[model samples]
Target: MKQVKIAGQVVPAIGIGTWHMGDRPAQRETEIAAIQAGISAGARVIDTAEMYGSGRAETLVGAALQPFSRQQLFLISKVLPENASRQRMEASLDASLQRLQTDYLDLYLYHWRGDVPLAETVAELQRLQTTGKIRAWGVSNFDVADLRELWQLPGGDQAAANEDLYHLGSRGLDYAVLPWQAEHDLPLIAYSPIAQGDAWGQQLTTNDTVKQIALTHQATVYQVLLAWVIRQPQVLAIPQTSSVAHMEQNLAAGDLILSPKELAALDQQYPRPTHKERLDII
Candidate 1:
């Protein structure tokens, strides 16, 4: 497994996302199995959110990780945007800790850009750090401007990461966010690195070079897509998978390397759209 360090903490380049694992007994079992399989296969980072089925996901993660030592995992959870106020932030994080069955989270993120003042939220995160409840802190869904605001806050130097959607189809970060992250020594955690399955089938079928590359490596389209994202020096990818086979396949992405010519061909074939448009196809 490839690893990236942020704020002096190390995590796997590809981690398991547990958003869809809540609300059913059978699904919960699958979630636990997938997590166990991921860890056994060398995954260290596990991402969850308080809003995922109203804390059900956190509970599942807590129960699943109980057997493992806290130090062995880089657990991360996000506080909902509505609860961004200092008081609400305190309560939300405490509840998340309780649900996760852990005393401290390796990283805690602000789930969205809510009405609360940025300074207030950053200060509260700093306070959580002082109390040892959170080891590192950062934000999610925050654009470049929002990141600048957070960085200007007191104690914001401890902010470790910025979570966002970045893929072959969505290159929003490449234009601005990526440069900022690299300049500041902040690592960008890429979610939906496979474009939520949009990079398969027709997209790959129409491109002969991508097909030939996959054939040469004996890899699937998903594996090739994930490898492309992680190949970037300052990027880390977290692709969600419930099946053991898929989990293994995703983890193997770090091992596959695309030649510069192949990479350029892919970039040319699937040129990133200039404007920021949220396409449902992904």
Candidate 2:
């Protein structure tokens, strides 16, 4: 697996996203096995949130991680927008930590901008970092303007990454958001890098160029799509799966380096943005 430098830490280029993991009791065992498969395949980063199944995903992660050394994983969890206030954020982190069965998180994030001020949130995150509660902190669904505004805050530069919707069809971030993060050496963590598993049904998978690349590499269209997202050095993609087979496919995709010709063909099929557009979020 490939690794990237983000927030002064080296981590896997692709992580596991546990969006709907612990919601169903019957599927719990399968989901846990899938995560364990990802870890066994060299995926060190695991992203979850308090909002995900209302912390049920965190609980699943805690149980799945029991077999591995806590120090070897980079655990990330996000606080909901309603809990952005200092006191509420603290409580949320504490609750997440308890559910995750960990002493500290590798990275904690604000789910999205809310009524709470960025400065206040950043201040609280810094305090948590200072107290060894979290290694680093970041924001999600922030646009270029939001990033600019955050940069002007008292301790906003401490933000480690900005996670948003990024896939073959959703390239709005390339216009400005991605460039901004790259300039600051901030990692652009892409959630739903495969478009919530809809990429296979979308035109991206059916395009002739995509088919050609898949054929040339002896890979599935979904794997090609996943590869395209993590092709860049500044980007890290988290694609969720409930099956160990898909987990293995995703990890393999991280290593499929696309050629310039293949990349150009895909670019022609899905052109990059020439002007700024509103960043897309799930």
Model 1 over residues 181-276: C-alpha lDDT tens digits? 788888887887877676444354335777787898999888888888888775778888778888888888878888888888888887755654
The ten-residue window of minimal lDDT in model 2 covers 197-206
Let me know the TM-score candidate 2 reaches against the reference structure. Answer: 0.97
TM-score of every candidate: 0.92, 0.97
* Cα-based RMSD of candidate 1: 2.5
lDDT of 2 at 280: 81
Whole-model lDDT per candidate: 0.81, 0.90
Which digits, one per residue and each the tens of the lDDT, describe model 2 over residues 1-282? 677877677988999999989999999999999999999999999999999999999999999999999988999999998898987988999999999999999999999998998888999999999989999999999999999999999999889999999999889988898888889888989999888766446677677888889999999887898889988887999999999999988988888989989888888988999998887877
Which candidate's lDDT is highest?
A: 2
Candidate 1: list runs displaced more than 4 Å.
199-208, 272-282
